[model samples]
Target chain A: MLFTIAWRNIWRNKRRTLIVLSSVVVGVVALIMNDSLSIGMIRQMFENQLGSHVAHMQIHKRGFNDNKVIQSVVPDQKRVEEALRSTPEVKYFSRRVVTFGLVSSAINSSGAAIIGVEPDREPNITIIKKSIIEGRYLSGASHEVVIGKKMADKLSVGIGDKIVGMASTVSGAVGSDMFRVVGIFRTVSSEFDKSYVFISLGNAQEMLELGKDVSEFAIILRDRGLVEMVKSKIAARLGANYEVLSYADLMPLILAQMQMYKESMFIVYIIIGLALIFGIINATLMSVFERMQEFGVLMAIGMKNSRLFYMIMLEALVIGVLGTVVGMVVGLAMYLPLSAYGIDLSMFSESLTSFGVGSTIYPVLTLQSIVGILIVIPVFAVLGALYPALKAIRLEPVSAIRYV
Target chain B: MNIIEIKDVEKTYHDNGVPVHALRGVTMTVERGEFLVIAGPSGSGKTTLLNVLGALDTPTKGKVYLEGEDLSTKSRNEIASIRLHKLGFVFQAYNLIPVLSALENIEFTMMLRGIPEKERHERAMALMEELDIAELADKRPNEMSGGQQQRVAVARAMVNDPSIILADEPTANLDTKTGANLLDLMQRMNEEKNLTFVFSSHDPQVI
Candidate 1:
């Protein structure tokens, strides 16, 4: 009977009820959209780094990540190859000889990281082949090189143009070689694009004065979920001389930024919830004041004060649940199509590239966020009804009956 | 037998910081099975006296006893319990909960007392039939005339079979014919059930 009464009472002033309901609905939709966009941006940034060069994990000489010097080459290369071939989780791997050097064309010169990659294996691990904008991938021919578009612009070189690469060798001698630019690639990260140049592994080994030695082995796994297990397995097999680093270990800054974004979203939820609380309070207080005499008659007829309080709270709950359910339906209606086709942010591509995100982003909504919305909105609505419920209970029957 | 007793009950309350004495040294007794009226003009303390008798307000001085229980000594919840189990009330406005149908209004008090649904429905229907409002069972207060709404209110009060019914100007909002008919209905109930009634009114017809 209390439920029946409460449900009916809300409709007594339909316009007021709808005003409160609409505010709650708007708050819920805003929360859902905001959460989805943040998640999408973070996910895009993480995937961009992985596809561009990081892969699932990497194996390097213990100190190669800290100092890109020519001497810190991987130890026991034969043992590393045997372990990688034996591990079923290893889908594909690329051996690279990496060194910081200067590349110069006839017109200009710029600093670059010279990465020597196996033409056949490198394309399977990184997005360099797909990101090529102007030329073909390297064909393992002697003196063939693939340079980023940004680096090519700085060096004033294009495909088939000759450039000189100079770096320090393991023997402490200056190693210089002339190579033809076979490709010009552009990745999501402008910084990565401006600093990297790739050449065949054999050509790099010959130029750098290293015999069958590579700086790092970038590995792509059959299943990304097995990154930690495979990293531990590889680390144990290669012993203490080699370091196995997962994507998370290779990109701590991006991970920290993602975590910070999640925390900030909590503040957004609180702001929306607080706004909803005030809206509900205002509506409930008006309803309570309007029905003062009716409440008096209820008290006079022996309705318990606690029952009256519950009735008011129940009305607010109905409004909240109704609004939240509608909002979720509307939010999902918008999210599904956006997730499928993605939201084009090409207008901000330059800024997005700086953050390692592509022009288009696909928003994602998790079950956890859905559960959070369901719990939070109704709880706030009930909290908003608290003061008005107390006011109703505090009325003296005689005075309330006489209330105009 | 005295169903209610009031001894020098005085009700003084503040109206904008000015203490207005609505009742002063008033003493009265109501017998069982009596149809009694506290007749007075406006501002004559008639409603205040009725409020005290109904356990809706506390007196500033003296005591009000209902069936030998001192209402002034009881706590708020205790007073509410007393009102639930022993008293019924009808306001001049016919205060049927506007959201409820006529039948729901009649069953409301019984529902509050935790009566079984089947029994509450049976009693409310029987009373609605007795009051000649069976056809209007599904109608809301807004759909009903003033006389019909008051009949539903009276039926609501009587559904719990309270020991006494306190009415504050029950016929003040009705036409003469309707007020006379309502009085006749109350007289019939009083004679048939031997139920005690207390009324506060300035109406000559009620007097």
Candidate 2:
């Protein structure tokens, strides 16, 4: 009876009820859209960072990340490469030899990190080819190099232009190598654009005067969730001499920043939900006051105050539940594409990428997030009912009956 | 045995700063199954006494007992349960919940008793059938005329089969003929069910 009465009571004034419920629906939809978009963008960023930049895990000689010295190269390349391939997670494994150098095309010169990669395995790990705005990927046996778009622009070089790379070797010897600028590529990260230059690993090794030595073996895996576990297993198998770092371990600052942003967004959602619940509570209280004569009659006809209290609360719950369910449904529909596809910030791509956000920001959806909205809305609704229920029980029979 | 006992009940209200007395040391006793009428002009303590007797209000001073239990010590919920199980009330203006149809209004009291729907529906339809408003059972309050609505109200009042039915100017909103017919239906219910009738009115026939 309580539910029956409460349901009917909502439609008692269809226009007023519609106004109240529509507000709730709007709040819910807005929250869902925001949540989905945030999730989707972050997921895409994580994937891009993992597959194109960091890979799942890396094995380094002790102290390599902190001190990138020439002597930091892994000593046993044959054994390390074999051990890495022994695991099923080893979808692609390659070596990268990195050093700071100046690339000059006679007209200009700019400082850059020259990354040596195997022609056969580099594309399997980093998305270098897809990023190529012009020219072709590395061809084995050619002393060709790929420079970042920014580097190419600064140096005034294009595909087929001769460029000279100069760097100091880890052994304190000045090293210089000449190469053809075979490709120019765009990177999502501004830092990558300003500093990164990719070349065939054999050429980099020869130029740096390193005898078949590699700085580290970068690896890709089937699932990113296993990054930590894989790192640990590799560490256990390889012993203390070798160190392993997962993507998060390599980029702690980015991961922490993302986590903080997510938490702050949740706070914003809570504030919105709280305000909506206040509107619901106030409306119900006003209606109760307006319907005092009815309550008085109900009380006179043997309707217990408890029953009356239940009736009032049921009405609130109905609005809460109905609004939340509908809102989530509508919101998720928008969330999926908005989060995954992101609201295109392409209009300001350069400005946004410089600030770390990509050109497109997508919205994402998750079950846990949907459940959170479900839990929060009803709690807010019930919280809104507290004062009104107290008022209903305390109203006087004679005076309330006299109320028109 | 008397069903109601009021002892030295004094009721007052604050009209702005000065206190106004609605009932002054009033006393009354009434037996079961008796038709009692308390009539007075507005603000003459009639409704005030009725509110106290109905356990919907407490006297400013003194005590009220229903079936020999003190009204003071019982909790608000206890008072409501007492009202539900042992008393029934009818009022002017139909006073039906606009949301519920006439049949639902009659089942409302039984619902408060925690009776299941099937039993409550059966009892409601049976009473509404007796009042000759069964044909209008599904109609909301606005759909029925003044006379039909009053008859439905009477059916709701008697549906619980309680010891007493209190009507506070039950015919105040109806035309004279509709009022007369409404009162006749209540009087007939009083005779057939041996129901106790307690009402406040200026009508000589009702008194």
Candidate 3:
């Protein structure tokens, strides 16, 4: 009977109920879709910009990561490589030898961070090959190189162009050699595209004088969620010889920046929720006060005030569920398209890159986001209905009857 | 048994700083199978007295006893239970839920008590047919005329077969013929079912 009354009353003023339901739907849908999209996009940016390319987890020489030089290379590479291969979670594992060097093109010159990687295993572990926006990816070990899109523009360099590498070789000689640019690629994040350059492990080893030694061991896991577990096991097995750092540990600065952006988005979500709650509260309060005479009549006919209370609360429940269903559909309709192609933020490339967020981010929908939005929304709507339900129950049948 | 007892019931209201006594220490008793017409001119406290007797309002100061139980001692829900099982009401405006059809309005209290749909439907249909409003049962309040709606309301009141039926200005919104016909039907239900009928009205036709 309570459910019937609530359902019937909703249709009494169809237009009024629609207006409220539409607002609720709009709020809920926008919230659900937006929440899903943003999370997915950020995850994509990190996996592409950091985790996938760099491996969700990495292993390093215990003290070598802090110093980061050719001399600090972890010597027991064969053992570490075999251990990573043997682990079921490890899908791809490779060694990295990194250093800073000055590269001079014909017309311009700039200092760039060079990543030396094995040509064979690089494509298997990272998305670096697919992101090549221009020219061909690296072919084999040679004096050939691939420069970032921004670096190419800044140095007036392109495919078929020659550049000079000036750095200390392992033999303590100032090594200088000219290398040809094989490709130029741009990733989603501007900072990465602007500063990063790639070269073959053999060429880097010869030029940087790293003899049979690499400083970092990168691993791509079958599941990104297993990063911490993989890192812990790898670290424990390697003992005092190596340090295993998750991508989170390797790039503290970028992670911190992304965390800050998330905090701001959370604040905005709260404001929207608060405004919606207020609207519902106002609507329900007015509805209760307006129906005092009706409630009095019900009581007059031997209807219980408690039943009236249930009736009012059920009305809110109806509104909340109706709005949530409508909103989820609408919000998803908007979000799916945006998440697929992503809103092009190319215009703000420089600033976004500086903030460590990709210029193009496709939003990802997760179960947690949907559940969180649904659970919190109904509770809030019901809470908003509280005042009105209480007010209806508190009406003195005699006093209200006087008005009737 | 005296189905309803009102003792020294006094009800007062203040209107714009002036005291108005809607019911002035009036006492009344209603017995089973009684057909009582409570009549007074406007402001004579007839509606106020009816409101108290119907348990729609508590008197400013007084006691109301229903079927040997002090209504004041009952919880609000208990009072509602009594009303659900034992009382029926008809008003001048009919007051049918605008969204419900005539048949649904008649079955509403039974629905409140969780009565099965088939039994309720059978009873509601019979009641409407008896009042000759059977064809209008499918019409909503707005779709039906004043006369048709009043008949439906009376049918709704009778469908519950409650211990008592209270009518407040039942004829105020109806034409002479419609009002007379509705009153005659109530008189028949009172006589046939041995039902108690109480009405408060200023309209001569209702009296």
Candidate 4:
């Protein structure tokens, strides 16, 4: 009966109830959408870094990651290959000859990381094959090269154009070669596009004069969840001489930013929740005051102050539950299709790429986010009702009955 | 046996900084099964005295007792319990919870007493039938006429079989015929169930 009364009391003023409910619903939906977008952006950035060039894990010679030099070539290439081949989790691996150099066309020149990749193996480890906006990926053809769109633009070179690449060899000599640009690729990171160029492994090895020695082995796992296991296994096989690192270890700054964004989302939720709290408090207080005479009659008829308090609290709870459920349903309705096809931000592609994010973003809804809303919204609603409930219970029946 | 006793009761209200005396040095008592009227014009403290008698307000300078227990000394919760179990009320405005139907309003006091749903429903139906309001049981207070709503309020007051029913101008909003009918219904209940009735009104019929 108390439940029935509380439930019916809310609808006594339908417009007021709905207005308050709408505020809560809007708050919930906004929180869900905001959280999902942030998660999606972070997830996309993480995946882009891995797919562009980082792969799932990498095996480098000691001190190579900290200081990329021609001298720090992989010490035990055969052992690393053997371990990768033996590990069932290793889906694909590519050996690269990496060096910093200058690429020059007839019109311009720019500094670049002149990477030498095995054409067939590199495509499986990185997104360079799919990222080709013009021309084609490396074909293992001698003197063939693939440069990023920004780099090609800076060098004023295009497909079939000849460009000269210069780098230091292992013997402290400047090794330089001329190559034809076979491809121009663009990735999520504009900075990466502006500075990296790819050529055939054999051409790069000969140009850098590193015989049978590679700079690093980039490994992609069949299941990304096994990245740590695969890295540990390969590291154990190659011993301490070879440094095996996962994508997380290789990109600490990006991961840290992702963490920071997630933490900041809680503050956003708090702000929204606080706004809803005030709204609920105002609406409930009005309802309570409007029915002062009725409440007085209830008190005179022997209804306990505690019962009256519970009744008001129960009304807020009903509103909270109803608002949350409807909001989640509506939010999910909006989220489902957006998550599937993603929200296209192509108009802001340049800015997105500069931030290392793709033009299209897919929103992700997590179990933790859903659970947090379920707990938080109702708790806030109840909190908002506290003052009004106390006020109702404190009213003297004799005076309240006479309240105009 | 006396169901209520009041000794030198006083009630004063502070409007802004000035004091207004609503009740002063009033003494009263009513025996069980008694049908009594506290009649006076408006602002004569008739309702105030009834409020004191009903345990809805504490006397400013006197002791008000219900069945030998001093109400002023009891905690607020204890007073509420006493009201729930021992006293009933009918207000001038019909004051049925607008959200509840006539039958629900009648059953509300019993529900507060933690009575089982089936028993309260049965009792509410029986009382509604006795009042010739069984047909309007499903109607809300707003859906019913003033007389019908007052009957439901009377039924609500009697549902729990309280020791005393405190009515503050219960028929103020009703027509004369309706007012007379309501008084006759209360008179019958007082005679039949030995229920004590306390009425505060300026109506000559009630006086």
True contacts kept of 4: 0.93
Backbone clash tally (model 2): 11
Candidate 4 Cα errors over 4 Å, as ranges: none
For model 3, the stretches where C-alpha displacement exceeds 4 angstroms are A105-109, A167-177, A223-229, A251-269, A285-291, A353-359, A401-404
What is the clash tally of candidate 4? 0
Q: Show where candidate 1 strays beyond 4 Å.
A: none
Q: How does model 1 score on DockQ?
A: 0.84
Model 3's CAPRI class is medium
List the candidates ranked by DockQ, beginning with the highest: 4, 1, 2, 3
DockQ of each: 0.84, 0.78, 0.54, 0.89
The TM-scores of all predictions, comma-separated, are 0.95, 0.95, 0.91, 0.97
Give the docking tier of candidate 1: high
Between candidates 3 and 4, the one scoring higher on lDDT is: 4
RMSD of 1: 1.9
State the C-alpha lDDT per candidate: 0.91, 0.81, 0.79, 0.91
Task: Please report, as a residue range, the 10-residue window in candidate 4 chain A with the lowest summed lDDT.
Answer: A228-237
lDDT of 2 by residue, A326-348 (tens): 88878877776665555887888
Model 2 ranges off by over 4 Å: A337-342, A355-357, B204-207
